[model samples]
Target: MPERGATGPRVLLRRLREVMAQPASAQVRLDRIVKIIAADMVAEVCSIYLKRQPQVLELFATEGLNPDAVHKTTMRVGEGLIGDIAANAAALNLADAQASPKFAYKPETGEDPYQSLMGVPILRDGRVLGVLAVQNQTRRHYTDEEVEALETVAMVVAEMVTGDLIDPASLSGEEGRIGPRLVKGLALCDGVAIGTAVLHEPRVEVHSLIAEDPEAERMRLLRAVDELRASLEELFARAELGAMKGEHREILETYLMFAEDKGWLRRMTEAVEQGLTAEAAAERVHNETRARMLRQTDPYLRERLHDLDDLTNRLLRKLVGEETAAVYALPDDAVVIARAMGPAELLDYPRDKLAGVVLEDGSPTAHVTILARALDIPMVGRVGEMADLLRTGDPVIVDGEAGEIHLRPAPDVLEAFRAKTKLRAQRRAAFARARTLPPVTRDGVRIALNMNAGLPFDLPHLAETNADGIGLFRTELQYMIGSEMPRLNAQSAFYREVLDTAGDKPVVFRTLDLGGDKLLPYGRQLHEDNPALGWRAIRMALDRPALLRYQIRALLEAAGGRALWLMFPMVADVTEFDAARALVDHELGRLDRFGKPRPADLKVGAMLEVPSLAMRIRAMAGRADFISVGSNDLLQFYFAADRGNPRLAGRYERLSPAALGLLRHIVTEAEAAGIPVSLCGEMAGRPLEAMALVALGFRALSMPAAAIGPVKLMVRSLTIATAERFILDRLTSPAATIRRELEEFAFHEGVIV
Candidate 1:
């Protein structure tokens, strides 16, 4: 056996090349590779375990211990030390093998003589294909250098496994696919929904592995790399992606760095030099890198692998001359499953057919996840290996509330869930009975419970909830839902229907809040580093007056002698608000001069989202006819926390002293100036959050139609005067948790929660 540095990597590579130069059989080459590794490491035993099936790993070759055990000794994932390494995508190193808790004895292997052990997972794109391990006679700890060297060797083997060099069927005894598996994930939205699987991003199968011309293949690889760079540049050049300036842009930047890494390119170039096509070489490198990252213990590193995986796919598409994959015709009640996706891609699906969404990778605060919540779709994210586990139209139940998935569930289990689902429907029906009840407090303080409407379809929900009015009429949804930007007449007709449906109830229209995640497909593409705080909302509208002008003109036309309340979103300062209002005044003058019917009563307002507006709340109050707090964006901007990241979701509590202090300041300023202030964000939808708002001097709240009943019930059961007192008392207590304290007060005061 070679000792210490007696056999370096160059020597091992030469020996491996010498062995392969003979043009032996696949089995012979695989066996020889393990033997050389054992000799180089001076190990008593070295073995290779390939995934014979998704759940089964078989000992394909061995240099010592027992050759008879090859292809015979097998372990299901999570069964033993080797299985654990494959299951968790993590390497295992131990001085004593049998004494370890995960140790499992195999009678056929005869590995009792070996004490120390090291095992590294062979992976491709976060999927484990096999495990490589070495054992020694004496107890010893493997160094970092040893692990890295062995991992490099494992990468070579991974390429062979994924390519035509090795037949997957020959290695696996299982005929085809595995069935009925549970995939864990991060729960994004709360609900339970049963539906058929609909894959958002279908896998692209690569047929060619070896190249006919090495030089041509290298050139092909280079061209694909250039095209990939162009595509990324085009993505950054978009005005629509302005919201992605920080973390989102950083992801692509890191990917570009990896794409340009000389080590990565050298590996692919060397593979091409060794008679593989550019596609084949890149695939091998991608799979090897993916497998290694999947095994990493660091969540951040593991998460970053998703980007590399995405970039690899993009390069392959360029090489294949394929445009972006398209959404298939969805089945009724389809549960959309994706690895990860942008918000625009999620919106492309037909909303009625889409029942739920399950993702292999996504954070709770991701933009698409927020859209899922708004659309009332049950969602679960970070579901590992979801694509491998199920096919299209497979029966699945996505339990977003519990963060569980039931695939091909047993009849008994289905029946149990059916009953649970029915009971939930009954509870919702009971809540609907409160629609006719007045939103007056126990002490007769009048509270306004308004519903927020988006699409034209949302009008029926307003009647169902008997909301006070449409507190926020999101006009952007109309643009988003359309295949192209609707004509000005089309926009006017839609607005007319929305107001007509409300019938005497007031409706506040938030003018086209596009840019960032709300971008229309037909509008000009935006390239922004961070659209959320950048040129979005009022900024986009002000810069592009034609777009804002047309929208306001439509609103004026729709109102036609009735009152028209228009709100400008993402107003940074009082001056921005005045400028937007000036546009509206200009439209009014044009209508008057042209002898056309205009809005009989025009009410202008601003969305309090940016901190600058809050700081100058008094100035805003003096100019604006009304003010509505967009709690979602306001809180998001206030903490400088990306609302799309699940890790930072609970970074700051809504009812915290700091948050309350900000709300109190806004409320005080608005009330002193005699302007009505309402909260129209996700925060107002929850009963607890709405209670907090009422205590902080907010008289009006707007949320989704379903939330109105719960929020209204809380309002009817509590006294604002008492809530105000509770607020004053807690203001002085630094440790006060309004969420808990208010809930306790509500309970004792006979308020419904």
Candidate 2:
């Protein structure tokens, strides 16, 4: 697109490299770089704004603007054009700056006459380090090519912004010292843990961007690409993946298409040929592609960028000769910090060593957080740019209850955390002594405290929690973790281990509840605008009857004369429950015909997750074995909110009147049928919520391992009749929510929070 011997991103990078290599001050290099960018982009103005912390960006260098504006103009992210680019981590191009709606007049910059503006985020890894901008006096539109080129240059210069070259001089105060930083985030799981930060996907540091020998770098790039292609081919050819052809096949082929893309290969080769190292070349193209993709308004397209980013991570590691195995060798007291992670990635870390997990990007319902809760590992998420703020082995404290982290905290802070932890430990110790004691309330009401488990890792905690039984063993996790369709034998073996671990203790396995967000690795994900309400759980299992039969058969075979308590999830109606139960009956008959061992006792139940199921409980009374209220899904649906969305987290409460009425209906229906009902999910994990559930006549409570002690303590303190009377009295109110009154009651009763 440029004339021969003229400039573009590559040329600008080359010139910037020369300037960086020069023996000059940081100020001079910044001044020269701005001038060079202005000249290269053929713009009248160029400026650099570096982020000093989480909130603000300061003008560091500029050319063709008011000289006084340099180091004087400051704006918080989202304050101006530069701020918008920084806030969104995207490029903002305008043909007319004054005409733009987001335009903010900066008198100090003295650029009121400029009509055109284009700014791109300077990024390192996934974090926005600063912003680079160019403006023109005449009305102008920046082409996609120009935006891409500038973003590429910005990537190359992001390291300089973060490094010592500008550090000591860039900061204006003592707090600017690059030491430890504290940040707050949303709590995903409950507990407290102090540990060292372990980056899940540690950056593959590329020291040399500009190569001494371009041809050699080109050859290196070619070899890496070839190896990468071969690796993908081998993955496709794997014997285990043979049956995965139609299911997970499209994913591999899509990856193959990217691996074999001519344009992608050319970009790498061209970058290498133009004096960049193989890793650097790949990084350049990857950054350029990401910068473009992440800026889009469409979420689906933005999500697709992760595939390319992952591929780049893999390629960079291969180019640098780094082994993936070594990257995951977790240290003691490890608190994993990741930009994001899949369920499998979270499972790979040893639970014994993994004290906590901190996600820069994640939701409450993410399986990683779910599993962390099961393991009693503290977790916090949505801490933006956490990886950039934390270094591996940096001392950090994860306060999941408060949803805060202290990086290299002061001694007094450490002592305070230790004291708090000790008090919790002492309380847990007291509860531990009563582990063998009956879970009976003060007025002699028996409570069935249980644990929610999914994996073999959860088995050990059962004894520790002193649970009466496993209330919800999510069978979907095994299928979710696998790469392909697991055969009947494999399914049976996994279920057998879960049964064996439970021994004499009762275990209620929730049949495969995959779909919605809990998608299988080897299954086609349905396209749905509102996934939570779409085809999932019993809906999916019933559509494919064979799949449901196989799991039922496995459960029967694995029980080996022991009683089997299995439940169906997301039962929209009594008919769905009947249909699901019919599958189990068919499996039982087929197993009987084949002389296969069946459960000595079989109890079928429906998960009361949908409000429709609660309404139809009168019809399901004699038909259903028992009912378990899935409080997580129930609350979200009752309030018409998505549980995965952080914004809606505080919108509803477990003790809301609607929730109380819905739950009361289930309890009343179950009582009329003389069948037991349980309340499980995140709500049961909190002591106050657990107390409210107990008050609502939910005798069985299944929760994360860490919650058992506190909940049991709450149960021991309450008289059920008194709690019921109090709750019923409060429920008479027409108010939408009763959480405030419930909290007051818990306080009056001295329930531990």
Candidate 3:
């Protein structure tokens, strides 16, 4: 064995590589890799344990830790340090392995010389493949350099074992080493892409249990109970303040009651009294609760698992003993995999490094999906809980566009993906070149193209894609991203940057449209039978003039002589429109008084989301400078179907008769009043929907950046006159027949509907 420090890291790495380069089978290569590691680190023992099928780790090769135990030894994840490392895909650098409580001594191995150990799990694309370790007799701590060196060697070892490089057939398990790569799963989002499987960001939240000093534990439980009650009180207060709907407040209050359940608290107190640490006690109680609740066959009861997980993680953070299981030094081009994530938490990651998102748990309405679409990251959700199957860095293939995930994908799969990726790049090049070619209709009617934006991060995309300007800038995102209410100055800074990005081009900014399914930091949600119809958007803003004024002032200050378009959401009545406009005027007056710079022409608009707004379109058009239809919310509220509820989801269709009638009404009224109107929502993004809107007398559309290309494709393919005629015919016909007519039109026009 080489003396430690006698050889530099490079020389050591070279030696290790030289050893692995020997002509040998996978097992031989693994053995030599371990041997080189032991020699370079001057360790008395070396071992490598690869993860077996399912969940067990089988001992593969070893130098000093019991050669006889090879293939005979096995450990379940969390059984020992090896087990823990395997389960968590984390490195273990213990100075005194023998003294550690987690160390599982094996008498049958007949090896006890090692007192210290350093193990680095072999990870490929965020999944654990195996562990590489070197143990020394002396109780010594491994340096950071040693850990890094070991990790690098492990990575090379993984490449060798997987045969991803060298022998392609070895990895592909077939001759020629290439074939069609196709894997399918449930679709979370509707799209197709060929991107590498990036694991979702790791989310490890732990809830703390109260201390077990009988009395102290009791007090701790009491404190948690009190905190739960206080949260409910705050929720109720917000509801009363008109910031939250009554139903949302009720849900929160119910959650608080569940948190204080006598039986649940009793279990937690028992764990604490049993002398477990706060975190452990909490975990135990959490496990018990999950087990108890999971047995229930009721869907509603089963859904409480999500709530429990959220509550437990929060409590674990309070305990302060919780450690994130995996520590990923993410690569710039890597994909992220996780069970699930909130919108704010997803932003913690470096956006550029992110390629796509793979989740074991996620729904269409999940906030993460909303952010993902805005970021243009290909994402798949509800991946059936694959987090446990993954390590910190396991090689994976995720095709967000195809709604597929491949674990340890074969070599042929990789090759086919690479080829498809090249083709996608070529297509993107075509799309980029086409962007400058103009979005004129076949008969020469030009269409405006704009991008939907939410955050400052989305600003750069304006230049990247063929977008005319910012269309719908969701203002609520600012409040949603922060822990508390963002100050007016902070809001102004963001708004100013956005307007400056747009330059002379118009940027439409939406006011705070938070409530119902969305959350507010300070306001209490009011109790109502149905939240969607309750306090939200313009309703909340009208009741909270301070919030409305603050946002208006920020927008005005940011415009600074630029052409600015501001819009409010859920305007149901002419009175509501008047009130909202009044608030905007009031804020402008204040901004003038404060000497804040203002736009030379700031146009205030109202989003025609509420059905009532659709009914009073003429009145609204008469009062407003411009109007933009928020179709996503409009359709939801129009049909009385909860947007997020999948059960009632299919009941309301965007292309349905009822929705089309309402849209036509708004368009006819807006045209008669000569108020320029545009649809700026998901409906505008759908090619057929865009066509229908244009045909139905709507002249402008605003959609997501990606949808711009497809919609423009439609625009270039059909004459505006033809589209207008078809739309009029469809609208004039009975509601029951519009869907078929639209489909036929889409087919005849080759619009790829």
Candidate 4:
């Protein structure tokens, strides 16, 4: 076999461009192109399979096989060796094509005689447009140079198919219109919204594929990379982002690392040297990287694909002299779509225009999801291949509550969602009207309804919901959102602002709940098999005394004669609480030593997230001022379920007999010890769950601001004694979940929940 080096592929590309430039029908052009690829690579067969639909790939042109099979042979996305390449968006080079498990016999194509095969996906903007493959009779592995040459040719072919050179309709059999479709995903936030799809970080088209001057393109590529790096540095230096330290900053740093990556630059430069424009080179390299990474099952590598795509798109825009930070002119009721994005990228869009967000890849704990919650935007994530199914400006109904996305929905479906949205609005209005009313039951039992908050955006809801106080002020958010560890003064200023915003309303400040999934950018991350159970929250704080001391100092400075309500998170035992409280004591002593004004009233509490803490509730009540049940973590721990895992979503019910019994035990112990206890996790925000907690003798509950009204309404309508009797009786029942029974009780009793 002859070595198809730099000159050979370039020579073939030059000839292919000549054929493409000629005035001919799409079929004639495709036929000639395949022949050129076969002759150049010294292969017995060459074929082009174009994606006509989402799942189906059709052979449009071929050489050295049954010529009659052109436009006749078809395969699904993952049916055969060709389909496997398309499905994974990666290249395949097989020594024995028939011996591969992925090989599927297609008698129509007469491909059985071919023993050696090499296939590469023709990718455009990270979407697999088609598969370009070559085969030979002899069983021999294709060399690296041969594979690179074929990939370069595939790049040229992608341009041809998408371009007017090959009429897409003639090749596929249908127009480009995508019909009505429904996609299911995980609900990251709650709400229903109807909107127009606005693709986030839209691809910059490469108008010029082949380079007129190789040296010029190389220089252009080098300049764009330098510009890309400088722009990222400038973004990092911005005052708003500079002081932030968390995953968002870490993501940007990763982006910068990709921008400056020597290997990434080398690959693009090599592509340019092989006869492609700077933009085309960047696109090709990214396509290859995306193909390789997409095949990886590792979540970390799959996630990095988004970062790589983002960087490549930025570089492409730079190469084309387009605005690197171009702001999109969003349509009314815009539903932003992306593979995945950092919080900062999501923030670039105007909040008012954004009706919701749909991600092909995202997690409930992702930073972008946190931001979406803060902005009060509905979000649905892990909706695979959404980009392929829907185009920009397509009508989209995001049913966040159901975790469903209806693309180009039917008129009736659209109307149904509109009605649902209106009904939701009406319910919210009703809740608002009754917001200021005290949450006192019909039997005159008073329940304290507080709001959980983290971001400054949440502070406004404190007044809106008429919450008694801030029950869980997640202080780690301030640390998470910045690019670097927030300085002492920055932390103090932020806490002070939060306190100022609340005014007279008490705020329970939960100290930095770092580590585990919520890792700090500057802090060292430990490799743990189960991060949730590993060193985090109180454990991490106790281990790093300075972290606790620094936050304690900030809270003290922020309080300055005001009341300070501090809480430690994930305290497994009484000893951890004692150690954490000692740091607080140390901070108070330091304030005294510095002659600084301390909080007028100080209250230190421990979150009962760990099941062990529940066992030691009596011991904890003796030392701690109050106990806030972190039901989200506590339930997961008790049930041995990972809350973040979608597979375990409904496996363990929150209203289960065992879960309620555990909560009842905690409340019983807390009441005996004379400590004011509250339930503050997601269970509190839910009306039905809140009803059950109230029955379990929890007088105080903290939830998202949106839940306050509904929970309050339930509280105002409840007969606590009746609910207690009903719930306690079912505690001994063998049901997997008591949700149905509770709902029945609520309905019969006229409980608003």
Best by lDDT: 4
lDDT of 3 by residue, 107-196 (tens): 656558778889977654335667788888788888876786676566556556554223322222233313233334545544444344
Query: Each prediction's TM-score against the native?
Result: 0.57, 0.68, 0.56, 0.72
Quickly count the clashes in candidate 2: 0
* Cα lDDT tens digits for candidate 1, 1-753: 234475655466556656655677767888999999988888888898988676888998898868899889999999999999888877788989889988989989999888999998886555677899999989998887677567656656675556534445444332333666666677788778888888776655555655667899999988888887776766655664555443344434555565666787788777676556688677767776776765543333454565566667777878877655444567888888788765545555677888899987776535566557656789998776676567888889898866788887777877877887897687577677777889988888888989987765468777778889999998886676444788999899989988898889999999988777665645666677887777788998999999899999999989989998989999998889999999999999988998889877889999998878888777765579999999999988898888668588676578877788888889998888788899999779888888878888899999977688788878888888888888777866676356788778888988777
Residues forming the 10-long window of minimal summed lDDT in candidate 4: 165-174
Stretches of candidate 2 off by over 4 Å are 1-16, 19-123, 127-184, 188-190, 193-207, 214-274, 278-359, 362-378, 386-397, 406-419, 525-527, 644-650, 734-753
Evaluate model 4: give its lDDT: 0.85
| Predictions in order: lDDT | 0.78, 0.79, 0.68, 0.85
How many Å off is the CA of 301 in candidate 3? Answer: 20
Overall local distance difference test of candidate 1: 0.78
* Pairs in clash, predicted candidate 2: none
Please give the distance, in angstroms, between residue 585's alpha carbon in candidate 4 and its true position after superposition.
3.0
Global fold similarity of model 2 (TM-score): 0.68
